[model samples]
Target: MNSKKTSQTEHPPGRSSTPAAWGALAVMASLLAAWIFFESLACGALHAGLTCASWMRGDQLSVGKLTYEGNGIFRANDVEFVFGTTGHRSSWKSERMEIHPLHLVGMLIRGKYQSFRLIRELKVGKSKLLVDRRGAGDGDRGEASLPWSESFMNPANFFPSSIEGGPIDVVVIGDAYRLSLSGLKLLLPDRWAGKVAFDEAQLDMGTWHGTFSHGAAVAGWDGTSLRLENLNLGKETALHEVTLALRDGRADFGIRGTIGKALIRGDGAFGSPGDPNALELTLVGENLQLGPLAELLGQDRRASGTVGQARFTFRGEPDNPLEADSSLRLVANNFRWDGRGWDSLRLAATLTGRKLTVSELSLQQEENILTGKGLVNLTRDWHEALKSPFTAAFSATLDDAGALASLAGPQFATLSGGLAMEGEVRGAENKATGYANLQGVGMKIHGLPVDWMKGNLLFEGDHVVLSHLDAWCGQDNISMEGSVQNSQPHAYKASAQIDVHNLTKRLGQLGIKTATTIGAGAVKCSWQGEGTREAHSGSFQARVTEWISKWTATGMSGSFDGSYAPGQLRLTKAEFLQDELKLSLKLNASARTLEVTDINATRGEKEAPLVQGSIALPLDAMDVWESGDVLRTIDTSGPFAINLALRGIKAEEIEELLGQKVRLTGALEGTISANGSLENPEIHGGLKIGNFVSLAGEAPADLNLTIDAAHGEFKGSLSEAIGQTPLLQMELEAPLRVVKE
Candidate 1:
């Protein structure tokens, strides 16, 4: 009753005040004060970050300059927050972030979010932020948005709405490639799923770098597919519109682009867009220019032509392309390497690891073609490959040598023939071995048709053998068989027959007509060569029958046996035989000296000497007549001799060789000897010219001379009188080496 009286205050409508009402008012006042204090704290700088460890449970949520605008508008500057809930570190921060004005309270009060822009940085599993790209045509389109990071939205809801600040670098492969993106903006319109647009994107790999500008794409709602617009990959490579779909951590993509000067279309599947490790692809190329591409690879600068068509498939890691398992088929049009050209080229091959298996290979130039199939080491140098051992069936044909004028010479420009070779080739390099069945049909040389030409060509080790080879022109034919060794002690053997009539005919056909008279005849020859590193030996035998010419004796037989070393040569025997004339010679020579002995020319079978001579020459004597030191050969290689004897030789025989009528008869005998250095030599020799006749026909032109030198003094006198005045006389007590300059 007392409390009622004391609390007899005014009440709105007959209501009594109680202790509970006062307590409620006190609690309300306390709460108002606390709310004001918390708001003040929220708007202030908190460099230490507000650690909500107990309830909200998070790392440092640092904030700066948190400002509150009336009407539920709020902004946070320099704020950072992280959510490590997906068993992965995912964090985001911004220098200036705009909280969703409409749903800020709902996001804080109920845990539902619309969007906010953390335009600075984001990280997830060593990767950068994801962007939600929305179409620009959408009426509601403004900026991109990102998803709220939670326990479930590892990457799905992590797409950011907008990206600012610096570029976001995303490493596609470890040290292999780096992709960078800038100015990313994403939005969600009403109808279509979403879209993407990039201000710039850069890709770097090894020595190559590519930049794409103003790229755009139409993306599916679930972030699983994208259709990109045209984008140029620098100026070297480019790509057009294509669709990329992702499923089960793999992306299937198809695009048309250019590689080097080639137009390429391809479709493939790879590990993932974020990080691709393995791939399976199929690519087709058309009109692929070769020269520019070859230059890019730093190969033959002269390479040219085009690959008409190519198809290939590869399945393996992209890092090691050559190690991939692949199959290829290529057709090249008018392919050329260096200066050599081919009308077309075709190749079908498969590669596994380092082995390249060829199913077919063909090269064609006009009617000439070469075809073969074999295996090769794909990783080996091409030069080494050419020198490697391999087995293959090869077929080659040569038609119309005119097409190869640069190689065969201009004389063969009009040559028309078909030569075919088919065989199995094995081994290579020093031990190369191969064989071919060679055939020639309708062969013509400079419009002169050949009756026949057939042969078998084979090679084993270092020797090349030509067996059962024969050539015929008109009524003339020659059988030939020879072997040529290519080793250190190289050697060769050859045999052939020469028909003068045919030879003259062939020469006449070559536009080189000669007026000199010649007799019909045949010459047979056999020659061989064998050698060692320091010495070489060779022999030749020739027989001429029914042969006669105005300048040469008729029916001559000759034999030569010789050997040569580094700087030395020896003619063991050299002899020639004509109807009634014979000549024999023996010689030895070195770099600095020459010696001839046993030299004689005889007539008749009785072997009567018509002329004989022995001469010695110290070649080093030339050194004194030249530059520098005047050390004559005689000063070094001493003791040499020279002698000559001429007997009963008619000048008419020599006149026939001159081919000019200088009426003369008889022969002259002469001798020469050296007794000192080349600079000053003691001379003891004589010449008998009285036996000869002069053109003046004056008394048969009797003339002779005598010479002698002693103590550097020279004396000579005419043996015959020149019209009663001793034809010529000379005497000198002074050294002949001295001259009045």
Candidate 2:
């Protein structure tokens, strides 16, 4: 009753909570909770979705185990993926893999306009792969990222597009994927093929797309061959089409291309892929450019213009490839050899079977031209042809020595002027022999000057013979013939005969003093020898006509004739004539000694006999001819004797031999003999003087002097008295000492 009625007040009526609004709130809350729940289950669902998609595509995947974690992370252990059909399948295996499933969903819902972040890690044995979101995006128009692979697939038939280099991008649009790369390098597998790089590269593939290019390309596959077309390799070459096919036991390849402005075409085939190689090829080039080819040939050369044309048809084994028909002609601007450059070269040659013919070959430089032609026969296997005899005929005409020196090496470098040769040569691998007619003008050979030369050269093995040689030595014209046989083994036989017209200044050139060669004369020289250099058993003879070697002795002349056999030599005649004196000698020699048979001298007329003598050296006591002593080797060694017989000699003539002037006029006669060893002789002789007169005293009737050999004493007596009495008598004793005089 009384309860709290005191505060009774009026209360406005409020609308009660409606079921529809409560239901709306409950629906919104349920939506948010369901979204969170679905997000939590995303990893497992994604894995199931992928499995279902793979199954629909008829692809197979084997996984040892699968796992799911928070934040939509899915993982698998031991997973294998297979692509392609049942007949030709490509497979890959992975030890472990991790993927973010939510990221894939985000990419799907964003409709490709927004960037989807992806993070993945895959491991296979020793190789690994990591993917980051930094480089994978919308073509080249957005930020780019690349996946990192730790290892490469074997055979490398396909490669994934990468963006680790300069600002490259990749994107997926519609049913295709595209990649853009700039300044990229791709490795080539061949050792000598080099590498292929590009300034900019682009690829877009839906299924099996094959068209691609840079400067060169493997364009597409047609039937059984790979076709490469429309390639521009710098400014040097342009290729139209190239095809390569390998099938069964045959391989075929061809090229239809252009280099510079030249058109080139070739086709090659290889039959039988076994031990021996067999191939047939036909190559034709028109207006082939030489400028670009010079770099590939050598760096020491430079060239320009074009070779006229070349045709080569070859069908043979590798060892005999040159057995086909081939010809080439070229004109080069600058040709170089041994670091020396020359100007302009024209070359042309043809080969057929074992015959090689050079039609035109010449070099022109510095106002010099060298032209040559040759025909050669190579009739055996390549190596056997080198060792066997080959026939060749060649001729060369040189306009200048410098050009010949360049081609023939340094031996001819010092020579100047021109040379010409015509020869037929036969050769083995290590030796060559030939016959040639050589002619030259204004040449210097071995530092000996010649104005002109002509010779016939004959060669056999290591020997050369110069026959009928006409050359100029100084001002003298010399005609000579010579030959050397067996020169290499050093037991040589040589002979030469020279006829010289003038010998005065020519002798000076041979190192004889001008004063020694005081007169001009003609000389005839002949020599014949057959021996080694160490010991020679030969002889030479020189004869000079009208010889005058001194001014004071006007009529001086000499003649010598000598012969040398095996161990013996004979000087048959040696005579010298000067004024009123005549001397003659004959000598014989053994291996180690010499013997003078007789030495005779006569002054004045033979009838008048102012002085005449016969001198003899008799050594007949010992037999020691093998000793190295001239007297002992040629004759007996002990008890040498000298005998002299003289008549009609004046005292003044005998005083001339003693270097004294005598005023006595006398006719002397003597018979002298000395006998002993050469070092000591016993004298037994006597001299008689008759009708002697001197300016200082009166004439004596006769005087006699006798030498006693046993007593070593001399006795003098006046045979006829002057003024009715014997004028003088004397006895003297003196020891005799003998010495070499």
List model 2 lDDT by residue over 316-337, tens digit each.
4432445555555666555655
**Residue 555 local lDDT, model 2:** 37
The lDDT per prediction is: 0.59, 0.55
CA-only RMSD, every prediction: 11.9, 20.0
The lDDT, on a scale of 0 to 1, for candidate 2 is 0.55
Error of 1 at 441 (Å): 5.3
Output the number of the lDDT-best candidate.
Answer: 1
Angstrom error at residue 220, model 2: 16
Model 1 per-residue lDDT tens digits across residues 1-741 = 878866765435655489998899999998888678755654552222234221133333666667765444456676656543222333455556543233445435542443332211221111244222111112222222233322323332323333223223332332245566765444333225555556777766666666666655554333345665555544355566567766565678887877577888988887631232357889999988887566544455565789999999987655555556889999999886545678998999987876778889887898888778976554344445555556667777877444444334555556667767688756656455778776667787666666677888787777878776876776666676777775656666655444433344565565545334443245555545555445655655544554454445434455656665566667778776665667788878775676888888887866668768887766642242232233333333354566767665456655654344658765656666655444455678776654455556555555676778766676877655545655545544445663312
Error of 2 at 127 (Å): 20
Q: What lDDT score goes with residue 265 in model 2? A: 93
- C-alpha TM-score for every candidate: 0.57, 0.41
Backbone clashes counted, model 1? 12
